[model samples]
Target: MTVMRFDNVSKVFYTADSETVAVDDLSFEVHKGEFVAIIGPSGCGKTTILSLVCGLMSPTEGKITLSGDKKVGYMLQRDQLFEWRTIQSNIRLGLEVQHVDSKVNRDYADDLLKRYGLWEFRNRYPRQLSGGMRQRVALIRTLATDPDLLLLDEPFSALDFQTRLDVCDDVYDIIKKENKTALLVTHDISEAISMADRIIVLTKRPAHVLTVHETHLGDIDTPLKRRESPSFAKQFEVLHRYLNGGNAV
Candidate 1:
């Protein structure tokens, strides 16, 4: 099933003096229960694509469609957790905002916390947790709302190298375990290769699809395991060249 579709979508930013096209004739589909990553050169308007999907912005031309009544949960670069709120409160924030903070929904949120090993820190502030743990909280908070599709915009970019790797695995595991579809936007080739089932490579500016690569890393279940696969380096090189102007093979 197609969870989201972008059909010939284009987005333009207009200034008083000039107009800039961020995305041009861009098109893609994110299937249900699939993890799709978008990777491109710096300033390639990856985040703009996410904004369009979440209705923060609309495309200037063409159509953007979400199947049925699907709700989108966005996890940004930083955890963006409120320091004043306890971890439990942080998780409930979304439910409250959406006015779905019923007994059943709150129970589901608690279940996620317990299942993910975050139950112990329920009363702790965001600052009390490690960077990795905080990110887990962020993911749980996003999940608490029971969104059908997730938009991850460089979700792990703010962490340190080692923390990023560990958190990448954690986030991937959570998303898959919950059987949720996700669209991630990142500039890291290796990160995209490790986490995404299918990767959409975009052109420089006025971003459009350059190529889409299906990562066939067998039954690898974790990002770290995917990175250690023999095919990992090979796939990385292919995407690296695509972003650099070399033709896709």
Candidate 2:
């Protein structure tokens, strides 16, 4: 049930004078319906990995595989919604881009808006919605395409602390309810601990898998609830130590 696999994947950027290695021998697997988070220090090529998966960039050496013909939907740091487009039109952007803007896809998009409580705002512009709601719309737009795997590239980093929390819960609920597989790249240790089923830690530069931890907090339904769990602090400390190059067990 592995939706995606990275086998010794390496990515290098070559300029006129020098070549910078962004990823080195990276290997990871994301299974069906699982939320996996990649955490590492800043400038660790985390975004490069997502680009590789989405076919925006090819690996310099090694292979990247997706099960069957799984399509990947990327939710970026910003909502990236067109200011001129109404919510309804914005939701259909992906479908239109993919040339699949048929009745069925449009209906599915409307259904998502309704289910997520954004139906009332369908005629409104992105400026009319709050930051959190805008993020929701962006997610729904991504879902409109019905991608097999989702790539979340720091999707909530732009939000304030409280809004980030609320949006995290909403996004997690939607993803779980839709039974979608997600791979999130985040620098927030607590965010990773709260939302991910497994956390993949990477090295500083020329990123590679440093370690992996299975978050045993799946039973705690929401991100806020998971944050309140007694083990939250302990897990955060473990990840923190790893990022700081401390020996942690």
Candidate 3:
């Protein structure tokens, strides 16, 4: 089922003398439980796309709709967890706000922490945990809300290379195991190639949909394994061309 649909959506920012068109007639559909990644050149309006879907901003033209309830959770590159809050409290804050607070959801979050080897640090403040663990906690906080769609905006860019790999694997495991749909925006062609079931290639500023491709790494599903697949280089090469606006097929 198509849970989220964007129909020729366009966004233009108006100023005193000029206007900036961020997204130009972009359209796409996200299937339920699928991981769709959007990759484009820097400042190509990828993050703008997420804002439109989440209702943080409305399109200047066209339409977007969520077939079901439009509950979205956003995870930015920075963990954004409050320094004063413990991991447990951070995870539960969303639930409390949504009024879904209960023993069941609390237990579920606790189980996730324990299962992911974070239980020992549950009472620690965000500053006390390692970068990878903090990002995990940030994701857990996002997930605790049980959002209908998860929007990840380059959620690993700040980590060192080694930590990024470990966090990427951890996040992939969490999202797939939860059976949730994810839409990730990233500039790393390799990262998109590794993590996405489908990849959307976007054009430069005032971005429009140049091309969309269904990508796969055969039956081996781990992000790291996908990166190692022989097809990975080929896919990156193709994506490079698309991103360059050269026959974005």
Which has the greatest TM-score? 2
Better of 1 and 3 by TM-score: 1
In the range 73-162, model 1's lDDT, one tens digit per residue, is: 999998899999999999999999999999999999999999999999999999899999999999999999999999999988889999
By TM-score, how accurate is candidate 2? 0.99
Positional deviation of residue 133's Cα in model 3 after best superposition, in angstroms: 0.9
Clashes of each: 0, 0, 0
TM-score of 1: 0.98
Cα deviation at 188, candidate 2, in Å, is: 0.7
Off by over 4 Å in 1: none
How do the predictions measure up, each by TM-score? 0.98, 0.99, 0.96
Name the runs in model 3 displaced over 4 angstroms: none
Give me the displacement of residue 152 in model 2, in angstroms: 0.4
| Worst lDDT 10-window in candidate 2 | 63-72
Which parts of model 2 are misplaced by more than 4 Å? none
lDDT of 3 by residue, 54-132 (tens): 9999999999999777889999889889899889999898888889899999998898788878889988899888899
lDDT for position 97 in model 2: 95
Q: Write the per-residue lDDT of candidate 2 for residues 95-168, one digit (tens) a residue.
A: 99999999999999999999999999999999999999999999999999999999999999999999999999
Candidates in order have lDDT scores of 0.94, 0.96, 0.89
